[model samples]
Target: MKTKRVMIASEEVEYDIIRSSRRTVALYIRPGGSLLIRAPWYVPAYVLLKFVESKAPWISRHRDKLKEIRPDQPSTMINAGDKIPFMGRELTVRAHENSRNGIYVIEDEIHVSVYGALTPEKITAFIDNWYLKEARNYFAERTQELVRLHGNILPVPSSVSIRKMKRRWGTCRSNGAILFNRELIKKDKELIDSVIIHELCHLVHHNHGKEFYALLESIIPDYRQRRRNLRNL
Candidate 1:
């Protein structure tokens, strides 16, 4: 991959072209803010540049998504006898031959009883699935609680739904169908609650205006902290 300079709106928007075996051209921005253009090994530089130029609008639109990019935190495997943090404290996972396939949060650690030795990737996959299941349950209960608490002040009667969104943590639809990012499962429970609460506030005010923020502040006092912690996760 090599970077080539290009001018956009009087600012230098760099274009990186990565040579690959397949015949394709795709552009992306790394989490660290580096721009990339992936293309086939045989594709010419001029052709790739033209494609990028045509997709400039798309590039800019995706830049907003890049703003949400946070540095990766160190992660370890959720293996046997390994302790991992949930909301704040650590839980130790203990694998037992007689135990069933499940995860339990014990004092100071989470216990995962696996049947056999698994790779870190496989363990993470299991943990992620477990969290997603838990998130669905938690969100359903909490959304109902919020509706009961603030429905009187909200502008519309909305329903909450869960889905795996790539670019957004949560979105409030005009019809009031709130959607949450499935990635939230990777974080702790408190962070997940914060995201839920944030979306619930949107039920009252759709936009991030002064009234919306004011209401959110009243409902979730430490929303900013929650936002920060979520980004860190």
Candidate 2:
């Protein structure tokens, strides 16, 4: 494996080159926009560079698309008519001037009513505020239900917290607090429940070793599938 810096359009992107006994060259962009190129061992560096250069436009477009959906890139501008994910579905955001300023979800769409001027900033404020509100109510409701069902087997967390987390879905602290990423409000309930149950398991076993996963399995049998689905988000 070798690393090479290639210029795509005006952006300098680093691509990892893996040489194997394969027959052809294949280019791919990983989840976080890391570039990977696979080629036969006989292929030379100059040939790979040429191929990447030719595919630069396509690669750059895809890289941007991947970056836009990255969990940590939450600061990206949320514009009107953009599709926002909430509870496993994508809803179109529509902002309009109204006497009352509020947000609502109806028939796979989000309606944002702005009492004054309707701008991108105004819509963003509405969306951000909406997500936070939903996160609190949704996560609280789920924690209560899941705890009621699994409280008999696992040690319950001392407290459950829902907050903004860029790179993690949830965290389990030794202090017996479970912090869930508020961004997960956009995801499905199963994934959220998986994360909550995961942290709850940690209250009994702090480590992710055999004992922890064993406890997790005993409670949620299909946790691995839910974890895989979470990554796709």
Candidate 3:
């Protein structure tokens, strides 16, 4: 692993260049905005630099796009004995050895299944993948469900993107593509609808104005309460 600094647009970007047996170089920006470049160890420094330079514009745009959607609150850490909110209920965390499984949910509890040994890192990784997978499937389904229910309010979004957003709940773009916070899967369905509706309303009115609220209210009579509940969550 090596740490390299390069100028991307106006910002000085520092990234971790990790070499592995992998055949391709991949660039990614993790949460808290850490950049990583995974590549073959044999790649030359000049080639890597040029690759970074070529991706500088994309890197800046990608970070800026995320900035438009994250929330204002600090991130929450998931651990054993901690309860997670899901579909309007708190799902308790429980870990057990499954010998051949990963994780699953039953009733109001989430079960983490492992094979031989367990560590905090392994548990965390399992839960992260589980939550993201759950979020992707559930969010995609709900987006379609809502579109069917309220497409008259506005047509369903052309597509939906799910990601681990920091501060914001969701963002509806001008192109009819919607970005949803994966964490929203933790909230109750009603609150989730309010978020979808809010963004959908943005398609008609891009600002928080009287008409936007009026449109939202038409769809969600208790939008105010639902928004408050999300804050409390």
Comparing 1 with 2 on lDDT, the higher-scoring candidate is: 2
* TM-score of structure candidate 1: 0.54
Off by over 4 Å in 1: 1-76, 98-100, 116-122, 154-159, 165-167, 183-191
Q: Tell me the lDDT of candidate 3.
A: 0.76
Candidate 2: the clashing residue pairs are none
**lDDT (10s digit) by residue, model 1, range 1-233:** 13357654455675554443546677877664446776765677788777777876776677657746873433665666676555445666665442224566656755554434444533554566566666677667777776677677544336656787867788888787878776665567767777777777777777889988888778778889988877776
What's the residue-level lDDT of 12 in candidate 1? 66
Instruction: Tell me the lDDT of candidate 1.
Output: 0.65
Clashes of 2: 0
lDDT tens string, model 3, 55-123? 877888787655455433325556677787777788888877654445778888888876445545446
The clash count of every prediction, one per candidate, is 5, 0, 6
lDDT per model, in order? 0.65, 0.81, 0.76
lDDT of 2 by residue, 48-70 (tens): 98999999888877888885555
lDDT score for residue 172 of model 1:
82
What's each prediction's TM-score? Answer: 0.54, 0.65, 0.64
